[model samples]
Target: SLHNSGLSGHNIKIGIMDTGFDTSHVAFARMRSENRILTTRNFLDGGNDVMGVPGGQRRHGTEVLSVIGGFDEGNLIGTAFGASFVLAKTESLTAEIQAEEDYWVAASEWMESLGVDIISSSLGYIDWYDTTQLNGHTAIITQAADIANQLGVVVVNCAGNEGGNIHWRKVVPPADGDSVIAVGAVNTDGFVSYFSSQGPTADGRIKPDFCALGEQDRVAASDNGGYGFDNGTSFAAPLLAGGIALLLEEHPLWRISDILANLKRASSITNHPNNAQGWGIPNFVNAINMEPYSPQRSLLIITPQPARDSVVFNMIFSSASTAILTVYDLSGAKVQEWDETATEPSTVIKVWDGRNRSNDKVASGIYICVFRVGDNNIRQKLAYFSR
Candidate 1:
């Protein structure tokens, strides 16, 4: 979709977290010529060189980068070749270690400090971890990803390649993170790949929020300095991340929630998401052309602001869910609260008659109106003037 639009993720900074990279590949020649590789970090050794050992370890990272930023006329054109990049070597494919999680967390912090707008993580952790811990809040990496999301970084992670396994076939963390966009694999025909991990997190939340081409996907071959095809959810993650970069390039001020909501709204399966394919595959054309995402779409909206008698709180969400609307004074005191459920994909309107919990008229100058749904929290300012 970005091909003809002249939109190529220009000026967008994306952090790639993988084993390592080999920037010498010809596929990345254009990017190298343009100096689009902003910086690099090797969390595994605290070094600056992200190109680690010259074997299979760095190859994965190289191929992942190629899928996002590589460019070769008549050969391979990445989803966002014009975007800038920051590479981080955060894993060792040959080593089975527990500290890998810490490495990922450290890399995330470093990337955030470098002002990366998005993080494309093609790695996942499941070793020595229990299936029950697939809950978003359990894994340390998931917690770190959540923190990154709160800091306004869009984290895109692979949904793991464990679908064929019967023992434990769930998504890995930080893919389990609520705020992270976990991407699964799909074939060229847009069918779910057999290797893409399933979702429905241990906490009953949808995991792999999106899907992308992963089977036989084209990637730069680091060893041969050419292009090749790869099959894994690892490839799918970066593909989706590259598309996200294009969107962010167009909408620089959009937040994580806004991006996710728009992606869901533009996905192949808008409604009924499941563990196998969360919201299905995303279409870049549909997403970019849709209405610009705003926090009010599924967050909170205060109507009749600077009200004289009463105020209405309009809380919208993608689906039917229960939420709590609480009003707090400037002094951090609770003024009033209401609990209501939206029975459908529509607005849940709650009216307040300028009264506190005591049902008595209260004098209010400025107050904070907060509406919380699931893991999303939105706040709006409300002003009340007595009649």
Candidate 2:
């Protein structure tokens, strides 16, 4: 029933960075024919050998892609069918750190140049074949990660599968980057997976920012010619990545941070956030329905800190008179309304004091400020930390 909205990720560009993808595979044939796959690059070889040899091995990238963008029926469906994709092979069967990490960085730059809306990397680096090549304690949060975040590209990485273990249980590299959305794994029943990584990063920030279904999740298989089952934060990352494409398609102007914040707000844990679930599982429907998530326009501003008094809002609208504004409480209660009046041309600014029609101070807490401008709507957070 989640797909009932029929809001496929049409026209968005998504980059899948992982090991080689088997383009020859039937699951991806349609994508190639329709030009849904914009281009393919292999940072691993610096050549066009994107397809692995005809064996059950080296197909991890293909499987991950199928989960995120594959289109099939009587089988698993991708989160974003209409979105276009760019394939970047940054990992290999060997999973070496130096080469793979270098490949990922280059691939990320290439994706940014192509203006990709999102990058879904099912790859992670913790232990390397060469012990000397291991990323040091600081590298996990620095070099590899910091560069990706600087590009303003939404990067989603899998939290490593080291849960239920005592050593190296946290996420690594790009996932450790403050800007990246590090994903953990959970079962269909919404319980955290035994293999899902845990954290409060080395710096002590809640990690595995969110989770998705990973235990026995469905994905396209290279040999079976149909959907198959798999598990891991690796699989979970793409599901969220695909969902992000849909979110981007629906609200294109959202900055990576805005999209992330709104997702956290709409996640199952808004009422009870913790390390295991971070902000909790993302609800695509709720994400789309929420205002302040408009697909167009890049900036959102809320004013008057003590919203208990009053507040003013300023926003950039794609066109004049295309937006409607409303206010709601944390409990999803509509406390105030702003009619859809024709906004003047150019950047429009509106003002709202915290008092309702009864002209009394609003209670202290969090509030939702929604803007509905034509098909584009966005919701911003307004906080009233004190009475």
Candidate 3:
């Protein structure tokens, strides 16, 4: 049996974009009481109140939010209940308009400025978009999603609930965006939901890059302030989004690309992803256990510290890369330098025999070891006593 990894998305910030949310539900009582909802914005009214008036139009967003951050012990626990949130009410309950897409883009930018690490959008736009425009770069929302990704935020969007509509069964905007994560729906039995959108973007890229339970998904109800059930890719998207948050919490230094790549690699159908299930359900626990992936720099671990004669430095790189390790004395003088390279995800070990750049034995004291690889510069204090 698989065991829990104890990751709860701590210190991670997620942005939820939809109609609005009801913070009065019992599932969200803990988050409300603890002040985990960092901020909110109602794009429909240009205000900060995303909760809206009582029960006016908060059902959809409320459910979506619950799937990610709602918490009620012994009842229902959301995927990333420990994560901070910034809510954006980008849709209207009365009608679906093109302006809502603009609101989505604006709200995403706002959330980015507020330092959100992930954006989970359960809303999609198709009123003004043609089937041919389902390419990754065509729609305005899709372009904005890519830009948000480039700006360092992981964008997660639903693959749309149009699978049953043969005439229009395809992923919606933003989900079709190359950089965004498009999630599809699976049932409790792990089978694809009948309504989850199918995708192979017009550009020929398989979409709904991940899958999650959406059928009869438990959520915080907006009607009577209790628990309920809902179904759609909307809920599935947030489930996966929350899982991404947990992964981010586990590997804070990992880049967005690293997170996505490893998650896909850990999915059930990594080697042969399809339109309906994409890469299949992701095993985040397995992903967390995968080798640490850092494309830009290598992780440094200096062993046998306070050395008398020699010490070993272990460096792990995610890809073919080179790194330089330099030791400096308290007076800012170079003591020794070591250079090593690796062609893949592997460790490089280097040993130093307490010598200077001129290959002569140096006086023992305290020294600083600085490891430089790509844009990462890691420094550690080392103590050396010459024999």
Candidate 4:
């Protein structure tokens, strides 16, 4: 719904890991066919044809890409409608879909090689992943996704459509990865889709970190001629991925971890997400506007880039100055906020045990410190390593 905000990914590069792309799709390529795609690869066939080698392809990837980067002005528009892309044909159209976890891992590394800022994967591995490995840290693909997180590349994935079934009670692998933003599907009515997978990884972490409009979503066809309605968590995931692209466009300096955290904070629920709807739906505009990590210069100095147990900072200003010291999680939630008056040369601010406003200690991760100094908001990064 943030479409009117006028945010576009422009120079940001997003990597699409799915069945493959339809190079001919106008959603990707306009009349002159200029901004449709950038680099592509077919990991399945080991070929340069990422626009799905017809026999080796399916329209799935094309539609997925359309949900993110497709642009046709009034006719259609994706979240990052103008963003560039790197398409990886990691999935096969074979009878079994023929995609193993290794192909996905290799493609992920390839995306990293191309320096993609975000990886939007509508793919999940379930065939070979045993139920025991559904824990957040298990599964080869899950580990690979964590690697992408380590590299600062935001990873988003579908939470699978296995909800309606009794046999499969949770989201598929890779989606179970804690570091990945696993997305579920919701209808326009704000109801969880019947087929959207449920979760709670085997390790007891919330799966499908968020949900998006997925049921009967209007989608671009691979033929590039007409649009049709599609339904699945796949579509929902890309829609959010595109939103993140738009966010990254405005705050290029934002850390991926912050983005992930802010996304949860800005979601409809804001806290205590359930597996059915994850953090509920995200408000795209709120998400972008809530990124408090965007830096501005100030006399405030946050000591210890990476902090453990506590964080100390010095606020220096001409004459005595009064300011608001706030701590916000990635989702822009004010974990801790208080008014401060720096009357001396150095009015030091120290946070012991990383507790928030409620006095509950924050978990080990990244946080943003915002100093509402005078008329400007200056921000600093704080990292916590749990004891």
> Which rank order by lDDT, best down to worst?
3, 1, 4, 2
User: What TM-score fits each model?
Assistant: 0.77, 0.73, 0.77, 0.74
Give the number of the best model, judged by lDDT: 3
In angstroms, the error of model 3 at 42 is 1.3
- Per-candidate RMSD, Å: 9.8, 13.8, 10.1, 11.2
Clash totals, every prediction: 0, 16, 0, 4
Clash pairs of candidate 4?
28-36, 261-331, 262-330, 262-331
Cα lDDT of model 2 by residue, 252-369, tens digit: 6566666887898889887777767788998877876677643455244776543555577876665666566777764567778766544554566777767765766677766667
- Measured on C-alpha atoms, candidate 3 has an lDDT of 0.86
User: Using TM-score as the measure, what is the rank order of every candidate, best first?
Assistant: 3, 1, 4, 2
Q: Write the per-residue lDDT of candidate 4 for residues 114-219, one digit (tens) a residue.
A: 6577899988877666667788787888898987776557899999998987778689878998889999999999999999998888888887899999988777
Stretches of candidate 1 off by over 4 Å are 295-387
Clashes of 1: 0
**What value of lDDT does candidate 1 attain over all alpha carbons?**
0.85
Cα lDDT tens digits, model 1, 254-369, are: 66767899999999997988888899998888887766565444667677766788898878776888888888775569988888788778977778789889888888576767
lDDT of each: 0.85, 0.72, 0.86, 0.78
lDDT tens digits by residue: candidate 3, 1-387? 121667778888899888898887888888988899999888899879888777759999999998899889877888998899999988997898899999999998888766688999998988788778998888999998997786568999999999998787999898999899999999999999999998888889998899999899998888888788989999999999998898888877576768888988999999999999999999988897786555545677777766788888888776787889998875568888888888887888888888898989888776777778877666555667788
